[model samples]
Target chain A: MDPDDLQAEPLSSGVPDLPPSDIGMSVEPATEAGAESDSSDTSSSSSMLEDDLLVLRRAWINERNSPELYTYEGAALENLMELVDFQLQSLDAQPASIQNDRVKYLVRSYLRTRLNKVEQHPGYVLREMKERLSQAELEYAEGFRSLQDAHVRKSFLDQFPAHLRRVDEETKDGLKMVPEPDMDRAVFCRVRTTVGQFQFDERYVSRQRRPAYLVQTTNMQCVVRTRSS
Target chain B: MLGDECFKLAKEAKDVTPDHIPAYNEELVRLVTQESRYLWRRVVELIQATESSSQQSSSGVFSPSQSTSKPDLSSQPFSNDPADVSRSMESENMQGQVALYVHTIERNKRCLMAYHRKRAEFLQSLLWAVHLAPTMVPQNVSQRLAPEEQNYAREYAKLNMKYRDSVEATLCPNDSLDWALNGEVPPRDLLIEVRVHRDCGEIVTQSGIVNLQAGTQHYLCRSDVEHLLTIGYLEHINPT
Candidate 1:
């Protein structure tokens, strides 16, 4: 028998077998709603086919550069490399989006830690900070949980406004709303309730004058601060 | 992409049934495959040639048996005239260049091991991919196992295992050195000599040698730097 007479398909990434819905339909966009609506049994079979294809594609991608698999030649090897390059290009093109989503959680984490500090620190506004902080904490948790089911986590983060610091009447008339220098710009958003919308021009500065958005607006700044020792 | 072009060529390049190929375009496939194979083999040959030259220089400096087994000639070799062949030979007889010898020996052993391991793995995977092709093999393995390929596979596995240990042990020392250099070097006693320099409060070593990976100038040292190379403390120094 000749060595060049066989036929085989590529392998898939060895992901733990997932539930049918996640492993199957989620890989590619569902193209046919008619096929889905006509028969549940047929839908399940088509879903399985999609699942198998995903498995095969993922396996080939994972092993593309692995020394354990394909090399620098042949059609299969070339296809695997092309797939990897495409994924890499996609990743590069969406850095801001990915970072924005990540920063959303990081901001919540930062605020949670700060709220803990506020609880420990002594001040007249501590009580007000504590109340708003607790509310923000609850909202952040709820938002995160809801985000898990969304199309993308970043858009969910964009919708979350709990990390914003509200300029409210606590005790001090003058206030400083300072943005964390290292905070990711993507997740950092400001909302002015008095204007009934988000504000772009009103930057976070370490001083207080009149509210920049509106006369009686609830000006909120998503800022980070260092706890004074 | 090159892949698409190749695929189109393969798809449209006339029927390669038993009537067309070298025994079914067998000879053409073999020639293309062998051309790539020969390119890599040429690379290995160059590596061997360089290694042999280094070994010869070392042997000229000192014989291996004399130094590892004997102790009388260590300090005396340094006195020989660097220009005189007879004196150099006598010096080599007295004290072998054990340090250079050991370095080269270890290096060659590592290179040969890497060469074999990489070659085997590449061949194994390449063959595996070819086997998976639509028109490549018969229906069953029993019919597909050519005696030569069977032997090649066994030999590949053996070489793969043999060199696997060496490859794993051979790590680049860039990261650890970078950490140490960054934290301790500026204020420490170790003087910056040769190409070592400080950047952003980090001590870094640089040398001028071509790098194999990415063929890019790495930030660490040149590829030919003779000191202990580990991935932990070494990085390639990119010119830019």
Candidate 2:
């Protein structure tokens, strides 16, 4: 449990050899029977293995789930290294008994492999997120450029419905209207109305009367005024 | 050693020098390139198969046996077989297939870049940790690194040293501590406001166990409720 002792030894010295058993397959019945026979003698060892497994599993899960970055400072890293060292020592002390339990051996190997991955998981995620962000930025830029190109090629009227175009045309027509004088009398004229030609008093047209016009053009009412002398 | 045997076997297989560990860069690159090519072919095949199947279905001449007799694409070993390559190339769907292949390659390249970037960052962090606390650097962390990663660590160390003084001046105390430790500063006694998202048991803290309920807000030190925040049971509210 001494940190100094843990730090003194090279980790390569503690690393166990590759398990002979294939991880995908279930443990052989012979190994299981052997494990059961020596169960009483190795109770403490088994419990320690179980404890180490739980801690490592939790650390692995946390490494996967946590938003926080992984580093060497955490209790999990220390605990994992310590457990690995312990497992290596046990394997050295009783090679036959340790190797006989196929399940334990598999767990140890799997744990070792996972520890490496777990340590690197945070960096992997950070890199992924950054690359994804850059990709998104590129997409955004492309989208913006396309939008600008579309906008530049067509006016708002051409891009939208005909109704908006008509409204724009009417507004331009309204703005173009001016009082025309012919010898002090105003001349008023109507543009593009469906109503029959009718005479209205100059005062009525000058007052901007609305109900007096009975013409509907493009679903909109239009009033015409001209000044005449 | 348990795991050391595996490395030894791999090293022997690769015929690496005794002093130099096998980085497996060439092997990984070859494998990835081959796999991508295989995947490209598989995708093209799948698309063509689906297209032909749909055409047959529409023509009211669907044959289940014919579709079933189609070669198992997954089992087909990837090779530079001229016949297979030429056959795929000659299809009228070549344009679409080529486009798909290009897109797949781009995505694969991006993934590889991300992986390398991750490794680089990990090495940089490791180097920084080693610089700050040599005793704490685990032997496994240092020994297992590839040659490229070792180079990355050396480069990062140089850059860090160059910017050390300037960076220290600009960084907040907490950030400075984090940089020095090469990790996040664990929750301590800093006061924080948190809103409960779900009902739970009272949190045991240095002061006492404080009752928590949904839709309730509490002002507590960070150390007392850091776990709750991590688990999404509570949310930290910024004072600003």
Q: DockQ for each of the predicted structures, in order? A: 0.01, 0.01
**Angstrom error at residue A79, model 1:** 24
| Runs off by more than 4 Å, candidate 2 | A1-229, B1-26, B34-91, B131-137, B169-179, B186-240
TM-score of each: 0.18, 0.24
The window of 10 residues in a row where model 2 chain B has the poorest summed lDDT is B170-179
> Could you list the iRMS of every candidate?
27.7, 21.5
- The runs of at least 3 residues in candidate 1 whose Cα sits more than 4 Å from the true structure, single-residue gaps closed, are A1-40, A65-229, B1-96, B118-150, B154-240
Cα misplacement distance, residue A16 of candidate 1 (Å): 26
Tens-digit per-residue lDDT, A1-229, candidate 1: 2212211221222223333343233323222422434555645544543544443333332222111211111222223223223333444532222222121222222222332233222132232333433333333333322322131112121222232112221223342221112212122112211222333457534322223222111122221111000
What lDDT score belongs to each candidate, Candidate 1 first? 0.30, 0.39
Scored on chain A only, each candidate's TM-score is 0.17, 0.22
Instruction: Give Cα distance to truth, residue B51, candidate 1, Å.
Output: 31
